[model samples]
Target chain A: MSDLTAPGFPGEAVRLRARTGAAAAFPPAAEYGQVLFGAQCGTPGDQLDAMRLVPPVFMPQRLAKLIDLGREPLYQDVELGTVIGGFSSPLPVYVSALGSTRAAGGDLGLALSRQAGALGIPMVIGENVVPVNGYGRLDEDAGRSLLGRLRAYTEHLGDGPDGGVAVQQSTEDADAEVWNLVYSDPAARPLLDSGRLAFELKVGQGAKPGLGGMTVVDAEAAARMAGQYGLDPVFGEGRVLRSSSPGTFTAEILRQQIRLMRNNFPKARVWVKLIPGRDVAEAVRVAVEAGADAVTVDGAEGGTGWAPSAFTGQVGLPLAECLRRIGEKPPCLLVSGRIWEGGRAVKSLALGATAVGLGRAALLAVAEDQQDGLIRFVECLSMEMRLIVSALGKYAPGEISPDDVWSP
Target chain B: MIEDGPTQPGDPRAHLSSPATRSTLRIQNQLLAAAREYLTSAGFTEMLPPVIGPVTDPGGRGSKQVDIDFYGHRYKLMTSAILYKQASLLAFDKIFCIAPNVRLEPLETANTSRHLAEFHQLDVEVAGASREQIIQLVEDLVVHMVQRTIAALPEEFAALGRDVDAFADLVQGMFARTTHAEAVADLHAVGHDQSADAEIDWAGEALLSSKSSRPFFVTDYPKGSRGFYDRESRTEAGVLRNFDLIAPEGFGELCSGSERTNDYAEIITRMRETGENPQKYRWYLELVKEGIPASAGFGIGVERLTRYVAGLDAVWQANAFPKLPGVVSP
Candidate 1:
């Protein structure tokens, strides 16, 4: 390195020094490692295997037109900020649907692990599994199977040089019984340790704050979930399911899960993701107090795979307020919703967030083209990030601060 | 003077005289044309967004709610044009819109001097530019609009005994840039510490006594006090890339604007912490996904602007059918 007192490059040196300071402030890279698994809805075995070689592969749903091919091609031109996976927030049954088909050349877990290892992107599997219906009852078997599969899948994937898998969990039933299985599963330990596997305790999503999620529990799936909950399968098709049980008691169950994860996998990061709402601060306080390592906030503008018209269009909070409240907490803040570019990411970081996830933007890349599309998306976001930092007279992601923002 | 009297109900033209109304309509038309020309010359295109939104986002402060039935679904009416700001960030690089907005204020008084339930706002936004460029554009547009309007109102100016040239000069002079800190310091220099935690009776009394020119920009607001999207000055303290065009009249603030937040992660965190879900805004986020060029924009309150120009004390006087407290009929 050049002399620290160099005239022409002192600014550069100072910037480099500041970047080093920021890196020091950041938790160890492995501590923040997130393993995102792309459980492509009905992805083919051959295509899934192909993803294993890529650094980090984001799998979009297998289109109806391509499902019969037994080889789904990844979008090749999408960028980093593009949204992947389902447009609407995924439901538990949705994951169940993928899981049921995973046996038939759709092993979402193996694909996620392989693609994560290949692309060098952390693995986070969006498992929209719920264990309850609109009527109070637990879908034990479905919950157990989903959790078991996730645990097994992460373990099978093992930890790369970086870390393990991060499971994005959306539970329908918040009872202790349901969480007990999720927390106590034997396979979850190793994945949680080595910082490979983690848990995302989802409360309300940005697309539908305070609105319960619905699962089109098919006859067979309904029977499985109902049997686990000890309920007679008397209800017909399209049974609506609420995620949280009676009162705020469900929060306790999440707390227990956090404790269990920490105790079992001391290095694993636990995050609680909630939609922006009137009561977000209180909710975040609960999550933090509940022993969460970080909190992920989703704004009303967040994309969902499918949601009620009212919930998607009329409910929840916007991103700005979410950042303001979450800023109060310095923990690892992973935010999602409609994040598209580097400037947006920089803005969030400045306002006090560790990182942001590209759900819709990621999906859009895959939907528009394939893996190339996804790569293009990431490139576009990275370029934007660099440009924004340069314009703000800063270098690197760490130097960007909230002081750089203002209202016109 | 005509006595205030009750008129027959449900009659559209019952209270109007054709000759007077015709002249008023003609003048309003002329004013609208002048304003439109000024904005168009400034390179702003007219655009519109869905008036009914899912929730009130961060930029929406002091906004009103309207109930509208959309294809069997009922939705609230928009209180301001801020919603269009985000939409404009997506579809158009630079755009403006003149539209009606509704708000529900429970504190209903019969004064009709400073309040209105429904009004029009001349909402303008520009992207892909810097803060300095936007300020210059706004100044030019305001000057153009005022010049044209005054030129067309020779009879009114003469009747009011107002010096048209002096008025024009005053408007032009106020455009000279000044910082908020400087303004506050000037106020303090006059022997009043307006910074006191308690209300400064002397400061308020002095300001009320002053006959300052109407229409000027208040630049460089405190960073912590500004909205989430504003860009803070790179080289100043307590100053954001923000400006408020205030009119010396009942219409206190005519326009409020600032540069937007361009950092992806910061934007996300702000949205989430504020209880806003980014999932609903996939398209909006895409604009910034690759990064956004430096830009700034502002919304000019149409009713307030018109009220200032027309010398109307109440906002209701500027609207065709003003909605005020407890007044159901137009």
Candidate 2:
């Protein structure tokens, strides 16, 4: 094994170890057991590369833009600004949902929030944080509670923050009243006032489509909740397997849930996160018809948390196919999977996606520089997006048509 | 064998041997007799409850069903007699059972007085009945049971510190009916978060129960939060024809009933929608295909009912061989 693959870095040995007891030539190593977190983690991006975007040599969109901007060959005034889930954003990009995994929650969560705030793009705080961590004034400087992520997201944001924070609730988080607490908190008053707050009903995620949320907890916590949740003590000693219900959903059920969200929390925007299920297109249509402001599709590639090995590649439809199935007429479609660079983001935007979510890419970008990592990473992506969109002769993300793409 | 105060925690036999346990058991016997007398007079046949089945209710509330090796095949311990209740309709139009159930409830729920790993339910079903009719029957049955206990065991009530007059309103058949939407709105108004799509969660149920002074019905839950057996409302889209009779003053839910979805194709579709393997329900599906009666039924938590009537602090006090969730007991 090479030195880079030895332990701390991403290399061939790591990939082999990830595939585990298989062979030298194998799939890339992911969360099956590696602890080294960065952008280069988890399973492959669910083959999003199946769809390609064609950059035309002609420039009609540029001429139309010239009419709009009242100028010439200058695609400089391209409007990247757009609305996502009822909130204004400078670009059609948002941070994908982040669960309370050890690698992502707490400080890293705050970092993601601060950077997302800086970029003025929306962020989704995933489930189990409140039940695992206390809902308090986290610290003098950093509050790590549900409100803490909100505060961090808003703190670094300059005047007139464009994007918002969407609090996503799983069955467990629902039990703990994650959204209720956030919606009523004085801390979120500013966000609500700015019309930049949303509550995402977690129907499914890309990692484990039909499965519930799973985590490894110690014996004490397990014993405390032994009567309320299922705990498989497979790890022995202190460790045990704890799981939450996956939540059941049918077509009528999806429609009714959205209506309920609208009725109960009338002040906030409603969003629904969907996994790439077998009926991805239908689910998207159901969500849209039910009046969802945004329907996020977590592609099979973007689960950054710990999940069982069986689900990573074997389960759920890929992101590209999900987008393709949702087809040309998009409904505030937000897509995510191994999307850090602008090329992939642009490709997603062209293939009937209203926006792209940054999952591992956002986390790793922060891990890359801590202070300027995410900003620099986003800047690089923005640069690529401008260059690519300009090449397509379209400035705004909405201008990217299905005619600009090929699907397989 | 009636002994002293504040019984031991783990072994229930010690508690059962106590005077408090004796009184509780006496009241419990009256409750059973009262239930049987009412059901039998109301033209219902009582049967011995089944211990295992080919498949059980997919209690999606995180509770698990125990599976045993039935020779080479797998059989599950009955979580509730719901499926069998529907099947039993073939033999008698109205059937009832004092059935035992086992649920591997989540560990954390051990604290809630509402949950238990092992318990009994007064399961009732009636063919060609509407959800409204069953809910009325539940109210009548509960009133009859409470009145029977009050008349037969006045001393038990006095000893347990419950006023018999507290049940007067029930005897008069006066109860409030709250829809799922109204209940959710109430919860939100009181600063609680309840999913409008799902059932009123445990805390929300307790809050609503605590606020009420008398037994009330929370009805018409949205589809998908319950088992596939609960029939969806044909007239009202996305709503189920079901109701949960919540015990007043924070005792939580005492009984849940719904109009059964009897159509075979619909049942299959529902099973798939609920993510259950359709092949596992071979026996029940075959019965459905052969046309089980259209029924509406409910399982009243016997211990919970007794706890509410006796004014006991916890449900375990109502059962001799009480099994608290996650607790090892006799």
Candidate 3:
């Protein structure tokens, strides 16, 4: 059949031709996979836990694997229905998470990307990519360097036909597509096509929201990312100021990231993760408006390796309430918290989440056994899902809708 | 008593202007002084912790509605003096504090005099001690406060025409020792049918229903039934090293005391099992790790005690700014 008149074709005459041909062949629901990949990394195992809580002075190849997990084939699988990639640490290591000052030094983004690639998982990255004066300070030069490193990694993954990286700039500074474009260049297109590139606009993290991120601004690294993203150069150990709290910087940053992603790779889906709070609905609305393909609502119950007790316990809304409110929107929603049992994940989906992310549980699995442990954890969750489904007389994960939920 | 005027129902201005029959301000001040002195003599340093905590770290029980700005930050009022108790353990070996605790009560009934929206507690904590020490301290303090009250209000007691002999006999009788088994046997001896398979609540009811005189201590509780922090008794019965100071009339339990757990590893394990983060309480764990001496502590319901002493029916009568049901302060 001609490409134009072929079944499932996008162009004109495709509808007319369908009337003369038999129904297109499609696989049974049970035959298809529902998992997707974003990046790769080591399973949170005993080995990692046993590693002294010290900073990584010298970057390890394993760190690179983590970053790769956040790249193409890994993230592509996450977008498609195969095996869902667990998004681990992609941001700079904080003192709390690492437990030492040395591990705080290395290229955190690169390390995370490589890890994601190794694990064949798509990881979320870049919350406060910009530098702030007091918090996560980054100069124009540092920003440029960091963007350059990201661009180099994306290019290495191979983006377009020429095998040369493609660079698409956003129309406006606040456009979300700006970061997406940078990640979807010709050099990175290969990874994007493979669903390894899962672009995200991080509105709020599990840590303090009003406060920006903190990263040791290496001039060389900052220049790389800055140059790649078309920002001015940064210099020295001086900190960079990104945005201030009670400000519109978060919304602006999200818009820019979305605009960039759409301009570069329209096929790839984008996500925005936010902490649940009293104004969660409003935040979700903002994310949706910024052109997020999906939204993740991280509840106060969600665990982080390190965060102030006050922020960890008091800052965010509960996952159930957040999901219930955000589910009003049509976008795919992912919820995180004490989602251990299958009932919990199913309950989350039933409450309006398209999926649920497990941080501590996943870490526990990895810490206990490594990759095998993580796989086992997932299996346990899947089995739990199956049992719950059978009990409810439902089949697919999508079948576990809000209709199955009941508030206590 | 029967003045006739236009019946302005529920009008504040039209109500009887007669003076309060029970002027308790002076008595209340004197009682507070006496309680503080007694606590101090027991080696408790006075302290005060922040009234506001992160909305999320509500020590225990249900979630609280915290006041926040447009950004959704939450600041909850202190629910209890437990935080201060925990903090004071770090500095003073023995400490005590009197503070107001607030909580929203949906089921407020006329008979619910014990459960108030807000109440006061004379919270105390002691480290480096034993269950016996806690019992002695609580018993002595209770007696001392009662004695002080009697001495200060001879005229009032005389006016009420209450027999001092009855009060003295009641005080002396409570100082006597009685085990849980003995208490149970006493109840049965008095024709209160208590089965061996009965729950603690059933036993508690049997004891409360008995025509026991004055105040007494209910000791040797089952370890599994009490909070995880309570120390288990070393005796054969495996009971918890805890006791409740029960009073006669309307006052049920005026004080709860126990020897706290000092084992760091066990405390962490228990906390983890309960799904509470041990990291958040790192400071508290440090104390146990440093090998703090085994101590016993107890908290007295200041409001309950005052209410009993003043012959007041409700706890609100003891509190200066009482938060009553259906009443919102400006």
Candidate 4:
């Protein structure tokens, strides 16, 4: 009868009594890493011997959905609409995390965020943005700061507030209390109020597991950073090794970190990014138990701003393998590494992923045509996704299951 | 080992050479000499450590290894001489060395009082020895050093305000032995969070160390938390048959040792599981493939031991030429 829904309304039970008269109706509301989870799509998708999607002739779930539809169902009836890490999305894809790439800095970052928001899917703003670019409230240097991305996302966000922006915090960022700063800032109030902000605690990346971030800097920069990082004049006398400390997370530390996030900022969602280490499944369990809204695992194929060449090729587990290792799904499992298309996306979803992240693919799409490039790319993906679901004799993205594909 | 002294720019001479650091330095020297005397008496031969090698230990806490140009080939500075310790087993069943190590530890470690950019370890390897035997050797060696120091120089302890009585209980008797599970539980009981499946973190380790009244062994660290050589336990699936010796009164980890794996197949599996490229360990892996002796050993941080013994403020004080991580010093 009234606006009151939840029981024991904190501010006033008197107003609830006035509306209900002890028998009134109450309306309720509900809310819901591949390579950075792209597998190595090396061969040009034209393998005559490549594996194909295999759907059973007796589609029990599809038949059930068809019965629910009160008629024979087609591919178009598939409810592609799903909630990803608390954000509503038109499709099951979200822009994967990206750091301060040249394209991720000023105008390009803004454009990408705007487009991601318009697409109604969530986006993760990756590490080092706060440390390299500034936090939004201060000088931020011509809108290349962390808050700049949020502003871009919020400005272009359409009427329904379907997308959220998750900002990742590395060890350096955590040392700077990036989450605390952003959570408490008035500038971020809009995103907070709209429930469109999340914080991703970065444990490790796929490109380099068990190692910190490594980058080369010129002699001048090295001299300045020599006191802050472990520097070496490895590339001759002119260049130095500038390394970042990886965030330490044993199972307990991870649990406590996620708990701390929930306690400190009740309004924002908590996410964790893990390198597909040998114990990916264990780490995922710990994260989910600690009340994380989502957990992202990046396979060894994930890219980074600065990583050793050896690490990229040799270090983490492949995304597909990581997913297979995890086996069963937690409540929300997001993957990335090299994920860019429909078949792989469908395979990942069928393999128990809640959603898939678009990393380098999103960037390249935007880079090729900043205005409509991403739009066209995502549209084609949506179409392919529909086709795959219909071919599987299922109508929803989430319905694509382990039964839909055959693996060796 | 260098004892803590005043640090000023352009001061070439060690502050340890000064009169104020004399007593601490004496204790430091005694600790080393006592270790040498004990190990040699125990029939351990000493080896000179290599400064550079093809690869170094993949320091798990994200400590970076220093790579140098070794005649146009990429060579890493010795982060730990554990690999060399294993190789030396080919020559001597019992080997010891006051080996130097360089670890580009994270900047945060600079504040922890236990870390040093350049330091030494009293490395001892015993071929054909069990984990218990090596742990017993450590106990005996540590006791002998302390008793020798306490008897030889009581005034040094007084001058440095270190209580000679700290070694009274440790003079004779095996130290406390706690499993990694027990230590984690103790930490949790103290209102601290510790990982059940990873290495006891730096903070957790310090917390446990500070709470102890005597030096203790925390054994059975998780398999993935360490370098590949630490042999996995047959009885325990997830744990390595390794141990870390934690100093009393919050000085933190003094040393780490483990039962080394000898099987080629097992080592390769461990290597891949740890994300280590087996190729990087060409020489060491060759030794494993060809068959090296099954042994157990530990390396005690020379400076860390000196700090705990002399009651110095930080590990840098134990160095004659210190490299306080991130600080440029000669």
> Model 2: number of clashes?
14
Q: Where does candidate 3 chain A have its weakest 10-residue lDDT segment?
A: A91-100
Clashes of 1: 131
lDDT of 3 by residue, A21-119 (tens): 111112234556865544346533121111221112343332443465664222112211222222221210100111111121234333333322333
Span of 10 residues, lowest total lDDT, candidate 4 chain B: B1-10
lDDT of 1 by residue, B55-91 (tens): 3333321122444556744345666656456556566
Best model number under DockQ: 2
Can you tell me which runs of candidate 2 are displaced by over 4 Å?
A1-250, A253-282, A285-342, A345-408, B1-8, B189-191
| lDDT tens readout by residue for model 1, A1-408 | 112121211233223222332232223467565755445676322111122211112222223314634554333211122111111111000111121211211232333333233333444544343332111124444223455445434444423344334555443332222232333344444543345445555565676676544434455655545423333323445453323211122343444444433433334466666768777777677677756766777777664344556776567766777777655635556666555545456666666665666554443333333223334444445555555544554433444466666632
**iRMSD computed for candidate 1:** 19.3
Model 3's DockQ score? 0.00
True contacts kept of each: 0.00, 0.00, 0.00, 0.00
CAPRI classification of candidate 4: incorrect
Scanning candidate 1 chain B in windows of ten residues, the lowest lDDT window is B1-10
The reply for model 4, stretches above 4 Å from the true place, is: A1-331, A335-355, A369-408, B1-14
Best by lDDT: 2
CAPRI category for model 2 = incorrect
